[model samples]
Target: MPQSETGTDTAEPVTDHDAQAATDADTDGSSENGSVVPWTSITKPTDDTETLAAMTAASAAEPGADDMADASLPLDQVFAVLKNERRRRVLGMLKQTDDKLSLSDLAERIAALENDKPIEQLTSSERKCVYVGLYQCHLPKMDSMDVIEFNKSRGTVARAANTDAVYDYLETAAPGAEPDWYRYSTILSVGGAAALGTALLVDPMTPLPVIDGTVGCLVIVFVAYGLGAFVWTHRAD
Candidate 1:
């Protein structure tokens, strides 16, 4: 009878040498050194390493880095330092003007512009009117906030609070803005009055009787003028 054709009996078995040869081939010749080098074990972070190195170099290259360590302040300080728009405009005008303007002169210029007349043609009264109005009205409020100073002798005044910083900020922020002298005059004048009031209140030199009599009279006059201004500005509105 013919031999049975079972598949298990016909299978071939591998020798030990063949198995060793197969292992060597699988390792790609690394097995000869008694250690197999892993093909995908560790990788160099070329892109990431280069980025980190670049950032470190950049930080080192910056000048005054140590000096600028305190550059940023808390939000409260930032808000406190910022000036209002009107004050900023006044500072800018003073910075750009070669001849510092007196309160009257500044107001005259504005009135002239509004009236469509030449600034040079404005009469003394027109100018003084602006000055008085501003001194008695606008300036006190601004002075209360410490935005400017009035020089009683020179008859000239200047920006008092954060003037430089405010101007610098405005130069970048509002390059096209021009000073509104009417507004400026008012603010400065009121500020001056406030200063006077403060001096009287603080210094004992101010005569108490004079304050109740002369100073009181002046205050009444100022209040009256201020009321007129309010009405005028109101009607115009």
Candidate 2:
């Protein structure tokens, strides 16, 4: 210790290592000394770090991720969701629109369809009946499965990524709009049987042999139509 003329002790200078040790001790996550350096200042994260992190979060938040998540839900669950005719009707209405609609508006329209009246003619009771079921049950359940994005607070309904799986099982056409395949098939069967019977009864020299190939062609058309219908209904699934 060096004493001053006034008999007070003078303080010694702090070495770089001592100051660094003080800093390192205060820092909770700084790295230790490297090969030649005694200590180094830790680099703080820049804005780029936050930017990259936000980018990663956005990518994970994409609709594709939600789609994949919904895909993991069992198909039986989806079928259960569709089991209710009201829910099916809800989905149908949503499928028709490209943008969000108010819950009140949706309920009113559905009520109109069910009541066979225009929306203007819908009674308060009719609207409330559909609205209550949708608000309390259907929309929440569908939203839970990620089938639709239901903003309960705002009362807005919008389509979501999971629509395809449920929609695939629905008849897109309006009631009675589709052709009567049963009737067509029946006519073909009657025609085919009569021609085959005629070919059998007529002489082989009377051009009746051509009926065999004609019946075969009709059979092929029937099979093709069946497969096409199957494929059409099950597509995009």
CA error at residue 47 for candidate 1, angstroms? 39
> Which predicted model would earn the best TM-score?
2
lDDT of 2 by residue, 45-95 (tens): 479988999999998787786476567668997887777767777888888
Candidate 1 backbone collisions, by pair = 134-186, 135-189, 135-190, 138-187, 139-186, 139-187, 139-190, 139-191, 140-190, 140-191
After superposition, the stretches of candidate 1 with alpha carbons farther than 4 Å from their true spots are: 1-89, 98-100, 168-237
Clashes of each: 10, 0
Provide the overall lDDT of each model, using Cα atoms, as 2-decimal numbers. Answer: 0.56, 0.78
Which 10 consecutive positions of candidate 1 have the poorest summed lDDT?
Answer: 66-75
Residue 43, model 2: lDDT of 51
- Across 14-114, the per-residue lDDT of candidate 1 in tens digits comes to 99999988776755434456886544444444698889999999988886643342243333432343433333334545676655557665576656755
User: What is candidate 2's local distance difference test score?
Assistant: 0.78
Per-model TM-score, in order, reads 0.33, 0.45
